[model samples]
Target: MAEAIFWVSFAFVFYTFAGYPLLLMVWRRLARKPVKRGFWQPSVSIVIAAHNEAMHIETKIRNCLELDYPCHKLEIILSLDGSTDGTEEIARQFESAMVRVIPSLVHEGKAAALNRGVAAANNKVVVFCDARQRIHPHALRQLITNFSDSTVGAVSGELILVETESSDDDTSAPMGLYWRYEKWMRGMESDIHSTAGATGALYAIRRELFRPLPEDTILDDVLVPMRIVMERKRVIFDPRALAYDKVACCAEIEFRRKVRTLSGNYQLLVQAPELLLPWRNPIFVQFVSHKLARLLTPYFLGALFVSNCFLLRGFYLIPFALQFAWYALALAGWLAPERQQGQLASRTAMVGKSREFS
Candidate 1:
């Protein structure tokens, strides 16, 4: 039973990170449904959700105004959620007929703000963007171009992490590697069926398919697109539609952000219980294999370590020794000098990225 528990936990962790992606690659190669890309123009609404982003609101508006899409077809909505800072004022300063400012009287979080902005959208194609990132001029055109395909319901753009010379090497290095790996996985998922979720920084979806997310919902990016997938419509990841954001210089901030996102995964499962039922959800296999399995990984890892301790005798001895050595090296890497530590993290991240994309 001890060995059984150890093996089960190990298998869970391995399957979640490594096995599922390998399976996706094989399946995608066997059956690929590529999006039909063309030069198509559709009425699009650009929704910006800002909370106390007074500094970037005006600049974000300017960036939106300069997008390569037709000015007549493009509408920009700046959704401000109880921002005490001059975010609303800055957005209103645009005073352009193309830009509309929606200010929520209270701090209702991002989901509510998005719901309000999306509700007021005049166009069928709703493109969600954040205040911090500057999207490429042609990104809007590239993203909406996917919708020219009748089967496509949503599309996500690639977000490039812009790192400056003065950026923190420790966090930015690993993050850059991870982001590349993430983009590759998303592209693969899109090719196979639909992306697991859309990127919040830059993603477009059909207005008619837009279900109002719960007020308390986090990870709107994942929830919205996954819901689209539930409707048996494709959600694609378009690398050509690129946007840029500064990498988080501090690990703590990134960690907190990830924690919130992970928690939202759990929230999503609760809010959309039907997604777990294979009969109800078209992408149930991918949803569980990719999303839910990852959420349970930490517990699987803990179980593997604990069970290994109990089964250290006989045949388990070799495996136990290997695990001990691995942990020891990991600890040593963390304790090494800053430069060496950063290098270790970068190497590990790149190795994972290479394996995923290879």
Candidate 2:
């Protein structure tokens, strides 16, 4: 019984993260259809919300200006959300006739900033980009191509982890691995239906479908695109359109980001319970495998530990031993100073910290 339970839990985790994604990929490949680019060019409003982002705001503006889109048709809107540093000042320096700057006195979160930016938008399409992320020259074009299909209400670009030129040690292995898996899963999900979520780093939606997110919202990227999905409009992933950003060099920094994201995801689940309901959403399998599984991972880990402890007195030595071995591996991963191990440790620490903080 103990062995069966162990396998069942293991299978659950595996299927949720890996098996389902693979199945989706296969399904997509079998029923794939080509999308043709139409001669339609819509005015695009590029909205960027910046808060204490002086380090990369200039680069972001330069990249946006250099994008391969019609100069007159593309408008850049930068919202400086109560930035104390030189963020607002630097952004204002780039304020030409094409770029508009919205300065706020209060430091609202990204969601509020984006809401304000979207309201100021006068284009048919709104593309949200992070101040830190650098987009490919043709990313906007690739995203606009998907708009050729009326069913596609939102389109997210592929995020590539830009290899830091300073590091020859391949210190970004864990992040690289995660991005590869994410890209694969997204491609598969796009093939069958809409992707489970979108990255705030680079995603575009029709201006008409824009909805103001709650002020306390953390994952505006996911919430915005999921809103489009709820409206029965397809949210697509375009791998050809790429945005690149350096993976966080500090594991602690990355862990904090992930914890905040997870907390926001929990909040989203509460706000949009219908999205998780199988009967309400026909593509329940994607939601369960992609989003729900991530939310339940900590609980699953706790359950596994408790079950192992409970079965220690029974005739389950082998299963208990296996559990110990698996935990030993995880511990080893935590102890090692290598990037991969550090990242694993950061995730584990986040689970513990989130529980404590909650």
Candidate 3:
């Protein structure tokens, strides 16, 4: 039983990180269908959900106004969910015929604000974004073009992490690497059938398909797209539709963000249990293999370590030693602040140089 538990743990960890991507690659090769793209201009309602974003709300409104899509075809909605920090005032400054400000006096959370925005939206295609990120000028156009394909119900934009002085520091570079890996996997998943979820930074969905989420839904980004996927519609990733945001300022902020996200995954299962039912959710295998398996990885990792220690005999001895060395290296790396600081600087320089040429 100990041996069996150890292997299950080991296999789960491997499958979550390595095997899923490999399987996606094979699936894409076998079933990839290119989304029909063209110069199609559709009316879009860009919804910006703001809380206490007084600092960035004005800039975000300006960014929306500057998008390359036709002014007549675009409607910008700033949904302010009780901001004492003058976020609503900042948003109101930009309200006009095309721009609308929907403000609530009480803090009702993002999902509630989004539902209100969707209700206020005049167009069928509603693009959701946050106040913190700047969408690229052509992102709206690129996102809308995906709708030319009838199969696609939503298109998620690429979110590029802009390196800042604070974000380029040691504790955040790994987050950047992880995000890049995630984008690559999302692209693969899109090529095969659909992306499992949409990036909250920038994503567009059909307004008619929009379901009002619970007031406290933490992963609106994930839940919204997955709900569309459940209805046999494709949720695709479009790399050309780009947005930029600074990475979480520090490790603590990033940790909190991740905790909220992981907790939302659990919340999603509770809110939409049918997602795990294979017949109901078309991408059930992908959902379980990609999203749910990741939630189990930490436990699997812990179980592997604990189970391996009890079987330190013959080949088990080698496995135990290797696991010890692997963890030791991770601990050493975590402890070496100076080394990581230098590496961060080097990485920033490399990224800057690459961006200059690209």
Candidate 4:
């Protein structure tokens, strides 16, 4: 029974990390449905959700103003949610016919802010972006091209982590490596069918498909797109549209952010139970394999480790050693210092750090 449990958990972990992506690769090659992309600027409303984003709000506004799309057709809405940090003051500096500032008296979180921002949008297409990232001017243009296809409802722009000049720099950073792998798999998912979700940093949707999220919502990126997918429209990915930013420089900060993200995934399962049903969610398989599997992986790893302890006679010893090695490598990656300018490229490990290896 222990052996059976061990293998079962092992298979699940393997499937979560490897087998699912392999399936996507074969699936994409067989059923690649390319987005019927075309070029033309439609009227767009850029909705930026800012909560005490005083540091990045001004830069974000300027970034929106420089987009390649027509000035007359574009509107920028700064939705401020109870920012005590002068975010409202900086945002008010830009209020005009082209820029609209909507202030919320209380800090209700991003979901509420988004609801307000999307409600104020005046155009057919609403582009949602975070204040921290700098988008490529052409990214808006690239995202708009997808709207030309009537079937495409939401489009996710690529989020690129700023990396060092040395290729070996990212090998020690776990988050950086994981994000790139995730993006690659998501791209394949988009090719074969709809990607399960959009990147929160940068994405666009048809203004009419917008749904008011619960005030406590998390993972708005996934919820918004999946809802659109439920409406029987394609939620696609376009790498040509780019948003650039640095990964969290501090490991502790990144860990907390990831924890909040994981909590959001749990919240999603409760708030939107229909997403698990095939008939209700158009991308059920992808969601189960991609989002749900990942949310459950850490628990599976625990089970795999515990079950392995009961059967450590001969062949079982190999996996036990491998598990130990895996944990050790993680520790080493965390303890490893970032390489200085003149250091050798091979100084970093391979598993945890992503941006350095990017």
Report the CA-based lDDT of candidate 4 relative to the real structure.
0.87
TM-score of each: 0.90, 0.86, 0.91, 0.90
lDDT, residue 254, candidate 1: 68
- For candidate 3, the per-residue lDDT at 32 reads 92
User: Tens-digit lDDT track for model 3 on 319-351?
Assistant: 799899999988897678865665665567668
Tens-place lDDT digits, model 2, residues 1-358: 6556656676776777768877887778886644545667899999999988878899999999999999999999998888876888898898987899998989988889999999999999999999989999999998999989888889999888776653223436766787798888888777677887887889999999998989888888888888888888878889999998777655555667789988988888887788877777645678778887888866766666666676776556666787789889878766767856656655776687566434
Residue-level lDDT tens digits of model 4 in 177-231: 8888999999999998799889888999999999999999989998899899999
Candidate that scores best on TM-score: 3
Error of 2 at 13 (Å): 1.6
Steric collisions counted per model: 0, 0, 0, 11
Tens digit of per-residue lDDT, candidate 1, span 80-169: 999887788777888677999998989999999999999989998999999989999999989988998989999999998898764677
TM-score of 4: 0.90
**For candidate 2, what is the TM-score?**
0.86
Candidate 3 yields a Cα-based lDDT of: 0.89
lDDT of each: 0.86, 0.82, 0.89, 0.87
Residue pairs clashing in model 2 are none
Q: Candidate 4: how large is its RMSD?
A: 6.1
Q: Which segments of candidate 2 are over 4 A away from where they belong? A: 1-4, 29-36, 165-171, 302-323, 337-358
Q: Which residue pairs does candidate 3 place in steric collision?
A: none
